[model samples]
Target: MSLSEKVKERFRRMFSDVFFKRYILGLWMMAEGLVYDMFDEKLHVIKTLPDTFDRIFAGGDYGINNPTAFLLIGQKANDFYVIREYYYDSRKHGRQKTVSKYVEDFQSFIGNDQPENLFLYPSAAALILELREKGIKYVRGADNTVIDGIQLVSNLLSNKGGRLFAG
Candidate 1:
Protein backbone atom coordinates (compact mmCIF):
# COMPACT_ATOMS: atom_id res chain seq x y z
CA MET A 1 0.00 0.00 0.00
CA SER A 2 1.23 3.50 -0.91
CA LEU A 3 1.52 6.08 1.81
CA SER A 4 -0.31 9.41 1.62
CA GLU A 5 1.66 12.48 0.54
CA LYS A 6 1.55 13.94 4.07
CA VAL A 7 2.76 10.67 5.56
CA LYS A 8 5.57 10.47 2.99
CA GLU A 9 6.65 13.99 3.80
CA ARG A 10 6.70 13.25 7.51
CA PHE A 11 8.67 10.07 6.89
CA ARG A 12 11.24 11.95 4.83
CA ARG A 13 11.53 14.68 7.44
CA MET A 14 12.07 12.10 10.18
CA PHE A 15 14.56 10.02 8.20
CA SER A 16 16.47 12.58 6.08
CA ASP A 17 20.00 13.67 7.04
CA VAL A 18 20.27 16.39 4.39
CA PHE A 19 19.95 19.35 6.74
CA PHE A 20 22.37 17.90 9.30
CA LYS A 21 25.00 17.12 6.70
CA ARG A 22 24.63 20.23 4.56
CA TYR A 23 24.34 22.84 7.31
CA ILE A 24 26.33 21.31 10.20
CA LEU A 25 29.05 19.47 8.34
CA GLY A 26 29.31 22.13 5.66
CA LEU A 27 29.96 24.85 8.24
CA TRP A 28 32.79 22.84 9.82
CA MET A 29 34.35 22.13 6.42
CA MET A 30 34.24 25.77 5.31
CA ALA A 31 35.66 26.97 8.64
CA GLU A 32 38.81 24.92 8.11
CA GLY A 33 40.05 26.76 4.99
CA LEU A 34 38.41 30.15 5.62
CA VAL A 35 40.98 32.97 5.44
CA TYR A 36 41.27 34.91 8.69
CA ASP A 37 43.81 37.41 7.35
CA MET A 38 42.55 37.96 3.84
CA PHE A 39 44.09 41.43 3.58
CA ASP A 40 47.53 41.79 5.05
CA GLU A 41 47.95 45.45 5.91
CA LYS A 42 51.56 45.64 4.67
CA LEU A 43 50.69 44.13 1.30
CA HIS A 44 47.31 45.76 0.66
CA VAL A 45 47.53 49.21 2.25
CA ILE A 46 48.85 52.21 0.29
CA LYS A 47 50.25 55.46 1.66
CA THR A 48 49.81 57.38 -1.58
CA LEU A 49 47.44 57.14 -4.51
CA PRO A 50 48.74 57.42 -8.06
CA ASP A 51 48.31 60.77 -9.86
CA THR A 52 46.48 59.16 -12.79
CA PHE A 53 44.36 56.10 -13.32
CA ASP A 54 43.14 54.15 -16.31
CA ARG A 55 39.68 54.02 -14.74
CA ILE A 56 37.90 55.75 -11.89
CA PHE A 57 34.74 54.56 -10.17
CA ALA A 58 32.73 54.78 -6.99
CA GLY A 59 30.73 52.37 -4.86
CA GLY A 60 28.03 53.26 -2.36
CA ASP A 61 26.01 51.64 0.36
CA TYR A 62 22.97 53.77 1.24
CA GLY A 63 21.39 53.40 4.63
CA ILE A 64 18.85 55.59 6.44
CA ASN A 65 18.52 54.07 9.93
CA ASN A 66 21.87 52.31 9.57
CA PRO A 67 25.25 53.71 8.59
CA THR A 68 25.86 54.83 5.01
CA ALA A 69 29.24 54.65 3.28
CA PHE A 70 30.85 55.37 -0.09
CA LEU A 71 34.20 54.67 -1.66
CA LEU A 72 36.06 56.50 -4.41
CA ILE A 73 38.20 54.03 -6.34
CA GLY A 74 40.94 54.46 -8.93
CA GLN A 75 42.43 51.72 -11.03
CA LYS A 76 45.78 51.51 -12.82
CA ALA A 77 46.41 48.43 -14.87
CA ASN A 78 45.29 45.52 -12.62
CA ASP A 79 45.59 47.35 -9.29
CA PHE A 80 42.68 49.18 -7.68
CA TYR A 81 43.04 51.63 -4.80
CA VAL A 82 40.53 53.35 -2.57
CA ILE A 83 41.37 57.02 -2.88
CA ARG A 84 38.72 58.36 -0.52
CA GLU A 85 35.75 57.41 1.62
CA TYR A 86 32.63 59.02 3.06
CA TYR A 87 30.83 57.52 6.01
CA TYR A 88 27.82 58.76 8.00
CA ASP A 89 25.99 57.25 10.93
CA SER A 90 22.70 58.89 11.91
CA ARG A 91 22.29 57.04 15.17
CA LYS A 92 25.68 58.05 16.51
CA HIS A 93 25.16 61.67 15.39
CA GLY A 94 21.57 61.66 16.78
CA ARG A 95 20.08 63.12 13.60
CA GLN A 96 18.87 61.43 10.47
CA LYS A 97 19.58 63.09 7.12
CA THR A 98 16.95 63.32 4.39
CA VAL A 99 17.34 61.71 0.99
CA SER A 100 18.17 65.09 -0.56
CA LYS A 101 20.79 65.66 2.10
CA TYR A 102 22.33 62.29 1.40
CA VAL A 103 22.35 63.08 -2.30
CA GLU A 104 24.08 66.34 -1.59
CA ASP A 105 26.65 64.52 0.49
CA PHE A 106 27.25 62.16 -2.39
CA GLN A 107 27.80 65.04 -4.74
CA SER A 108 30.14 66.78 -2.34
CA PHE A 109 32.04 63.56 -1.82
CA ILE A 110 32.54 63.15 -5.56
CA GLY A 111 33.54 66.80 -6.10
CA ASN A 112 35.04 67.53 -9.54
CA ASP A 113 36.19 63.92 -10.05
CA GLN A 114 34.35 62.19 -12.89
CA PRO A 115 33.93 58.54 -12.03
CA GLU A 116 33.34 56.26 -14.99
CA ASN A 117 30.66 54.42 -13.02
CA LEU A 118 28.84 54.60 -9.73
CA PHE A 119 27.94 51.16 -8.45
CA LEU A 120 25.40 51.14 -5.65
CA TYR A 121 23.66 48.74 -3.36
CA PRO A 122 21.02 46.90 -5.34
CA SER A 123 18.15 47.78 -2.97
CA ALA A 124 18.98 51.50 -2.74
CA ALA A 125 16.33 52.54 -5.24
CA ALA A 126 15.59 55.96 -3.79
CA LEU A 127 19.24 56.99 -3.64
CA ILE A 128 19.86 55.60 -7.12
CA LEU A 129 16.94 57.62 -8.48
CA GLU A 130 18.26 60.81 -6.90
CA LEU A 131 21.76 60.25 -8.32
CA ARG A 132 20.35 59.44 -11.77
CA GLU A 133 18.25 62.63 -11.69
CA LYS A 134 21.40 64.57 -10.85
CA GLY A 135 22.86 63.37 -14.21
CA ILE A 136 25.44 61.02 -12.74
CA LYS A 137 26.52 58.76 -15.60
CA TYR A 138 26.73 54.98 -15.49
CA VAL A 139 24.88 54.64 -12.21
CA ARG A 140 24.14 50.94 -11.79
CA GLY A 141 23.26 48.48 -9.08
CA ALA A 142 26.08 46.23 -7.85
CA ASP A 143 25.89 42.44 -7.70
CA ASN A 144 24.44 41.53 -4.29
CA THR A 145 25.48 37.93 -3.99
CA VAL A 146 27.47 37.59 -0.78
CA ILE A 147 29.36 34.38 -1.49
CA ASP A 148 30.20 35.32 -5.05
CA GLY A 149 31.39 38.76 -4.01
CA ILE A 150 33.50 37.29 -1.24
CA GLN A 151 35.07 34.79 -3.63
CA LEU A 152 35.84 37.49 -6.16
CA VAL A 153 37.51 39.69 -3.55
CA SER A 154 39.47 36.73 -2.24
CA ASN A 155 40.69 35.84 -5.71
CA LEU A 156 41.73 39.43 -6.38
CA LEU A 157 43.63 39.69 -3.11
CA SER A 158 45.30 36.30 -3.41
CA ASN A 159 46.36 36.53 -7.03
CA LYS A 160 49.80 38.05 -7.73
CA GLY A 161 48.65 39.16 -11.20
CA GLY A 162 46.29 41.77 -9.67
CA ARG A 163 45.75 43.50 -6.36
CA LEU A 164 43.08 45.52 -4.51
CA PHE A 165 44.36 47.98 -1.94
CA ALA A 166 43.06 50.68 0.38
CA GLY A 167 44.67 53.96 1.33
Candidate 2:
Protein backbone atom coordinates (compact mmCIF):
# COMPACT_ATOMS: atom_id res chain seq x y z
CA MET A 1 0.00 0.00 0.00
CA SER A 2 1.03 3.63 -0.49
CA LEU A 3 2.40 5.48 2.53
CA SER A 4 -0.70 7.54 3.11
CA GLU A 5 -2.83 4.50 2.49
CA LYS A 6 -0.77 2.59 5.02
CA VAL A 7 -1.23 5.38 7.49
CA LYS A 8 -4.97 5.36 6.84
CA GLU A 9 -5.04 1.63 7.38
CA ARG A 10 -3.32 1.99 10.70
CA PHE A 11 -5.71 4.72 11.69
CA ARG A 12 -8.60 2.54 10.65
CA ARG A 13 -7.41 -0.31 12.82
CA MET A 14 -6.77 1.93 15.78
CA PHE A 15 -10.03 3.83 15.50
CA SER A 16 -12.11 0.93 16.73
CA ASP A 17 -10.51 0.98 20.17
CA VAL A 18 -12.67 2.61 22.83
CA PHE A 19 -9.61 4.51 24.11
CA PHE A 20 -8.88 5.88 20.64
CA LYS A 21 -12.40 7.18 20.15
CA ARG A 22 -11.65 9.68 22.88
CA TYR A 23 -8.23 10.31 21.38
CA ILE A 24 -9.85 11.80 18.30
CA LEU A 25 -11.64 14.30 20.47
CA GLY A 26 -8.61 15.08 22.64
CA LEU A 27 -6.62 16.85 19.92
CA TRP A 28 -7.86 20.15 21.30
CA MET A 29 -5.76 19.96 24.47
CA MET A 30 -2.49 21.66 25.46
CA ALA A 31 0.77 19.99 24.45
CA GLU A 32 4.11 21.73 24.67
CA GLY A 33 7.72 20.64 25.07
CA LEU A 34 5.73 17.62 26.13
CA VAL A 35 5.62 16.65 22.44
CA TYR A 36 6.99 13.21 23.21
CA ASP A 37 4.38 12.93 25.91
CA MET A 38 1.56 13.55 23.49
CA PHE A 39 2.58 10.92 20.95
CA ASP A 40 -0.42 8.62 21.21
CA GLU A 41 -0.01 6.82 17.91
CA LYS A 42 2.67 4.33 17.03
CA LEU A 43 6.00 5.87 16.04
CA HIS A 44 7.19 5.61 12.47
CA VAL A 45 10.63 5.89 10.96
CA ILE A 46 10.65 7.14 7.36
CA LYS A 47 13.72 6.95 5.19
CA THR A 48 12.38 9.56 2.78
CA LEU A 49 10.26 12.65 3.11
CA PRO A 50 6.68 11.95 2.15
CA ASP A 51 4.93 14.07 -0.49
CA THR A 52 2.22 15.10 1.93
CA PHE A 53 3.30 18.49 3.22
CA ASP A 54 2.41 21.81 1.68
CA ARG A 55 5.95 22.94 2.47
CA ILE A 56 8.94 22.63 4.81
CA PHE A 57 9.82 25.14 7.51
CA ALA A 58 12.70 25.43 9.95
CA GLY A 59 12.78 27.07 13.36
CA GLY A 60 15.85 27.83 15.44
CA ASP A 61 16.83 29.10 18.85
CA TYR A 62 20.42 30.09 19.60
CA GLY A 63 22.19 31.15 22.74
CA ILE A 64 25.67 32.02 23.89
CA ASN A 65 25.52 29.92 27.05
CA ASN A 66 23.41 27.03 25.76
CA PRO A 67 23.69 25.14 22.51
CA THR A 68 22.19 26.37 19.25
CA ALA A 69 19.30 24.28 18.04
CA PHE A 70 17.39 24.11 14.77
CA LEU A 71 14.57 21.93 13.57
CA LEU A 72 13.61 21.22 9.96
CA ILE A 73 9.88 20.62 9.96
CA GLY A 74 7.55 19.42 7.25
CA GLN A 75 4.06 20.87 7.36
CA LYS A 76 0.93 19.05 6.20
CA ALA A 77 -2.43 20.57 6.92
CA ASN A 78 -1.79 21.81 10.48
CA ASP A 79 0.72 19.12 11.48
CA PHE A 80 4.52 18.84 11.19
CA TYR A 81 7.35 16.33 10.95
CA VAL A 82 10.89 16.89 12.21
CA ILE A 83 12.75 15.97 9.06
CA ARG A 84 16.22 16.96 10.28
CA GLU A 85 18.19 18.89 12.83
CA TYR A 86 21.28 21.08 13.20
CA TYR A 87 22.57 21.32 16.74
CA TYR A 88 25.77 22.75 18.19
CA ASP A 89 27.14 23.32 21.63
CA SER A 90 30.42 25.05 22.40
CA ARG A 91 30.32 24.13 26.03
CA LYS A 92 31.37 20.62 25.15
CA HIS A 93 34.55 21.94 23.60
CA GLY A 94 35.14 24.66 26.20
CA ARG A 95 34.78 27.29 23.49
CA GLN A 96 32.05 28.95 21.47
CA LYS A 97 31.59 28.76 17.73
CA THR A 98 32.12 32.13 16.14
CA VAL A 99 29.29 33.75 14.25
CA SER A 100 31.00 33.03 10.97
CA LYS A 101 31.60 29.44 12.01
CA TYR A 102 27.98 28.97 13.08
CA VAL A 103 26.84 30.50 9.79
CA GLU A 104 29.05 28.17 7.80
CA ASP A 105 27.90 25.07 9.66
CA PHE A 106 24.26 26.16 9.43
CA GLN A 107 24.61 26.66 5.68
CA SER A 108 26.30 23.31 5.28
CA PHE A 109 23.64 21.59 7.34
CA ILE A 110 20.82 23.06 5.24
CA GLY A 111 22.69 22.32 2.03
CA ASN A 112 20.69 23.23 -1.22
CA ASP A 113 17.27 23.53 0.41
CA GLN A 114 17.41 27.29 0.58
CA PRO A 115 15.05 29.83 -1.04
CA GLU A 116 12.61 26.94 -1.34
CA ASN A 117 11.15 26.02 2.03
CA LEU A 118 10.63 28.88 4.45
CA PHE A 119 13.36 29.31 7.11
CA LEU A 120 12.41 30.77 10.43
CA TYR A 121 14.38 31.47 13.59
CA PRO A 122 13.31 32.77 16.94
CA SER A 123 14.29 36.40 17.50
CA ALA A 124 18.03 36.50 17.99
CA ALA A 125 18.81 39.95 16.65
CA ALA A 126 22.55 39.55 16.35
CA LEU A 127 22.52 36.04 14.97
CA ILE A 128 19.74 36.84 12.53
CA LEU A 129 21.58 39.91 11.23
CA GLU A 130 24.83 37.99 10.91
CA LEU A 131 23.16 35.10 9.09
CA ARG A 132 21.47 37.53 6.72
CA GLU A 133 24.86 38.87 5.73
CA LYS A 134 25.82 35.33 4.75
CA GLY A 135 23.12 35.04 2.04
CA ILE A 136 20.68 33.22 4.30
CA LYS A 137 17.15 34.55 4.59
CA TYR A 138 15.27 33.98 7.82
CA VAL A 139 11.94 35.29 8.99
CA ARG A 140 11.24 35.80 12.68
CA GLY A 141 8.96 33.32 14.37
CA ALA A 142 5.80 34.58 16.03
CA ASP A 143 5.89 35.69 19.69
CA ASN A 144 8.68 33.26 20.66
CA THR A 145 6.40 32.01 23.37
CA VAL A 146 8.03 28.86 24.75
CA ILE A 147 4.85 27.36 26.13
CA ASP A 148 2.83 28.01 23.04
CA GLY A 149 5.42 26.74 20.55
CA ILE A 150 6.05 23.61 22.57
CA GLN A 151 2.34 22.99 22.85
CA LEU A 152 1.93 23.39 19.13
CA VAL A 153 4.72 20.95 18.43
CA SER A 154 3.35 18.51 20.97
CA ASN A 155 -0.10 18.69 19.46
CA LEU A 156 1.25 17.88 16.03
CA LEU A 157 3.44 15.04 17.25
CA SER A 158 0.68 13.57 19.36
CA ASN A 159 -2.24 13.82 16.95
CA LYS A 160 -3.90 10.43 16.37
CA GLY A 161 -3.93 11.26 12.67
CA GLY A 162 -0.21 11.99 12.81
CA ARG A 163 2.07 9.54 11.01
CA LEU A 164 5.81 9.86 11.55
CA PHE A 165 8.89 7.75 11.03
CA ALA A 166 12.47 8.75 11.70
CA GLY A 167 15.07 7.44 9.31
Candidate 3:
Protein backbone atom coordinates (compact mmCIF):
# COMPACT_ATOMS: atom_id res chain seq x y z
CA MET A 1 0.00 0.00 0.00
CA SER A 2 1.12 3.53 -0.73
CA LEU A 3 -0.13 7.06 -0.18
CA SER A 4 0.77 10.51 -1.42
CA GLU A 5 2.67 12.82 0.99
CA LYS A 6 -0.42 15.01 1.48
CA VAL A 7 -2.62 12.06 2.37
CA LYS A 8 0.00 10.65 4.72
CA GLU A 9 0.32 13.96 6.50
CA ARG A 10 -3.45 14.20 6.83
CA PHE A 11 -3.63 10.70 8.32
CA ARG A 12 -0.88 11.56 10.76
CA ARG A 13 -2.72 14.67 11.86
CA MET A 14 -6.14 13.05 12.19
CA PHE A 15 -5.38 9.83 14.07
CA SER A 16 -4.56 9.37 17.71
CA ASP A 17 -1.31 7.70 18.81
CA VAL A 18 -2.98 4.31 19.10
CA PHE A 19 -4.73 4.67 15.74
CA PHE A 20 -1.60 5.93 14.06
CA LYS A 21 0.38 2.99 15.35
CA ARG A 22 -2.24 0.56 14.07
CA TYR A 23 -3.11 2.18 10.75
CA ILE A 24 0.28 3.40 9.64
CA LEU A 25 2.42 0.68 11.18
CA GLY A 26 0.19 -2.28 10.40
CA LEU A 27 -0.44 -2.85 14.12
CA TRP A 28 -3.59 -2.97 16.22
CA MET A 29 -5.01 0.43 17.21
CA MET A 30 -8.16 2.15 18.46
CA ALA A 31 -11.03 4.23 17.04
CA GLU A 32 -13.31 7.04 18.20
CA GLY A 33 -17.07 6.69 18.79
CA LEU A 34 -19.91 7.18 21.29
CA VAL A 35 -22.74 4.89 22.50
CA TYR A 36 -24.89 6.84 24.97
CA ASP A 37 -26.88 8.54 22.22
CA MET A 38 -27.31 5.25 20.37
CA PHE A 39 -28.61 3.15 23.27
CA ASP A 40 -31.96 1.41 22.62
CA GLU A 41 -33.42 -1.09 25.02
CA LYS A 42 -35.54 -2.72 22.35
CA LEU A 43 -32.37 -3.60 20.49
CA HIS A 44 -30.08 -4.47 23.40
CA VAL A 45 -32.14 -6.21 26.07
CA ILE A 46 -33.07 -9.88 26.09
CA LYS A 47 -35.53 -11.75 28.29
CA THR A 48 -33.33 -14.78 28.89
CA LEU A 49 -29.68 -15.71 29.02
CA PRO A 50 -28.05 -18.91 27.89
CA ASP A 51 -27.97 -21.67 30.47
CA THR A 52 -24.31 -22.26 29.79
CA PHE A 53 -21.49 -19.95 28.87
CA ASP A 54 -18.30 -20.42 26.91
CA ARG A 55 -16.62 -18.15 29.40
CA ILE A 56 -17.39 -16.38 32.65
CA PHE A 57 -15.62 -13.43 34.17
CA ALA A 58 -16.04 -10.77 36.80
CA GLY A 59 -14.99 -7.15 37.12
CA GLY A 60 -14.75 -5.24 40.35
CA ASP A 61 -14.06 -1.72 41.54
CA TYR A 62 -12.94 -1.17 45.11
CA GLY A 63 -13.75 1.89 47.16
CA ILE A 64 -13.19 2.83 50.75
CA ASN A 65 -15.00 6.17 50.77
CA ASN A 66 -16.78 6.03 47.42
CA PRO A 67 -18.75 3.27 45.67
CA THR A 68 -17.71 -0.32 45.03
CA ALA A 69 -19.13 -2.46 42.26
CA PHE A 70 -18.83 -6.00 41.00
CA LEU A 71 -20.29 -7.41 37.84
CA LEU A 72 -20.60 -11.05 36.97
CA ILE A 73 -20.52 -11.47 33.21
CA GLY A 74 -21.27 -14.53 31.15
CA GLN A 75 -20.38 -14.97 27.51
CA LYS A 76 -21.50 -17.33 24.80
CA ALA A 77 -19.76 -16.87 21.46
CA ASN A 78 -20.11 -13.14 20.67
CA ASP A 79 -22.95 -12.43 23.07
CA PHE A 80 -22.45 -11.21 26.64
CA TYR A 81 -24.77 -10.84 29.58
CA VAL A 82 -24.43 -9.18 32.92
CA ILE A 83 -25.79 -11.98 35.05
CA ARG A 84 -25.57 -10.05 38.30
CA GLU A 85 -24.33 -6.85 39.84
CA TYR A 86 -23.30 -5.94 43.38
CA TYR A 87 -23.00 -2.30 44.28
CA TYR A 88 -22.41 -0.48 47.55
CA ASP A 89 -22.05 3.22 48.23
CA SER A 90 -20.38 4.28 51.44
CA ARG A 91 -22.03 7.69 51.56
CA LYS A 92 -25.49 6.27 51.06
CA HIS A 93 -24.86 3.32 53.35
CA GLY A 94 -23.53 5.60 56.14
CA ARG A 95 -20.32 3.68 56.76
CA GLN A 96 -17.33 2.15 55.09
CA LYS A 97 -16.69 -1.59 54.95
CA THR A 98 -13.56 -3.11 56.36
CA VAL A 99 -11.33 -4.81 53.81
CA SER A 100 -12.10 -8.20 55.31
CA LYS A 101 -15.81 -7.50 55.30
CA TYR A 102 -15.64 -6.48 51.69
CA VAL A 103 -13.79 -9.67 50.84
CA GLU A 104 -16.40 -11.78 52.62
CA ASP A 105 -19.15 -9.98 50.74
CA PHE A 106 -17.33 -10.46 47.47
CA GLN A 107 -16.95 -14.16 48.06
CA SER A 108 -20.62 -14.45 48.90
CA PHE A 109 -21.47 -12.48 45.80
CA ILE A 110 -19.51 -14.98 43.74
CA GLY A 111 -21.31 -17.88 45.42
CA ASN A 112 -21.50 -20.99 43.23
CA ASP A 113 -20.56 -19.19 40.02
CA GLN A 114 -17.01 -19.92 38.99
CA PRO A 115 -15.43 -17.01 37.17
CA GLU A 116 -12.42 -17.70 35.00
CA ASN A 117 -10.91 -14.41 35.99
CA LEU A 118 -11.47 -11.38 38.15
CA PHE A 119 -10.35 -8.10 36.70
CA LEU A 120 -10.06 -5.27 39.16
CA TYR A 121 -9.34 -1.62 38.50
CA PRO A 122 -5.59 -1.20 38.35
CA SER A 123 -5.43 1.31 41.21
CA ALA A 124 -7.43 -0.82 43.65
CA ALA A 125 -4.33 -2.14 45.31
CA ALA A 126 -5.89 -2.71 48.69
CA LEU A 127 -8.73 -4.81 47.39
CA ILE A 128 -6.45 -6.75 45.10
CA LEU A 129 -4.18 -7.65 47.98
CA GLU A 130 -7.06 -8.67 50.20
CA LEU A 131 -8.60 -10.82 47.50
CA ARG A 132 -5.28 -12.49 46.74
CA GLU A 133 -4.58 -13.09 50.41
CA LYS A 134 -7.97 -14.69 50.74
CA GLY A 135 -6.92 -17.36 48.19
CA ILE A 136 -8.77 -15.92 45.22
CA LYS A 137 -7.48 -17.25 41.90
CA TYR A 138 -7.01 -15.60 38.53
CA VAL A 139 -7.14 -12.10 39.94
CA ARG A 140 -5.59 -9.53 37.65
CA GLY A 141 -5.47 -5.78 37.27
CA ALA A 142 -7.58 -4.44 34.41
CA ASP A 143 -6.00 -2.85 31.36
CA ASN A 144 -5.89 0.95 31.57
CA THR A 145 -6.60 1.41 27.87
CA VAL A 146 -9.57 3.72 28.18
CA ILE A 147 -9.96 4.86 24.59
CA ASP A 148 -9.41 1.40 23.20
CA GLY A 149 -12.00 -0.10 25.55
CA ILE A 150 -14.56 2.62 24.79
CA GLN A 151 -14.13 2.36 21.04
CA LEU A 152 -14.45 -1.42 21.11
CA VAL A 153 -17.65 -1.21 23.20
CA SER A 154 -19.10 1.52 20.98
CA ASN A 155 -18.45 -0.51 17.86
CA LEU A 156 -19.86 -3.68 19.39
CA LEU A 157 -23.03 -1.91 20.53
CA SER A 158 -23.62 0.27 17.48
CA ASN A 159 -22.35 -1.85 14.62
CA LYS A 160 -25.04 -2.69 12.07
CA GLY A 161 -23.89 -6.30 11.82
CA GLY A 162 -25.01 -6.85 15.43
CA ARG A 163 -21.98 -8.95 16.25
CA LEU A 164 -22.18 -8.30 20.00
CA PHE A 165 -24.64 -7.34 22.75
CA ALA A 166 -24.87 -7.19 26.57
CA GLY A 167 -28.07 -7.74 28.57
How high is the CA lDDT of each candidate model?
A: 0.80, 0.63, 0.80
- Model 1, range 1-167, lDDT digits (tens) per residue? 86788976776565324343345335333335445335566777879888899999999889999999999999899988888899999999999998888889989998988899999887999989888888876799998887887776777777656788888
- Model 2, 31-86: lDDT tens digits are 43333543544354455676666776666778777888877777676555677888
Best by lDDT: 1
Overall local distance difference test of candidate 2: 0.63
Candidate with better TM-score, 1 vs 2: 1
Clashes (N, CA, C under 3 Å) per candidate: 0, 7, 0
Judging by TM-score, tell me the better candidate of 1 and 3.
Answer: 1
Give lDDT: candidate 1, residue 53: 93
Best by TM-score: 1
Against the hidden true structure, what lDDT does model 3 obtain?
0.80
Q: What lDDT does candidate 1 reach at residue 167?
A: 88
- Model 3 TM-score, 2 decimals: 0.72
Candidate 2, superposed: residue stretches over 4 Å from native: 1-35, 39-44, 51-53, 115-123, 160-166
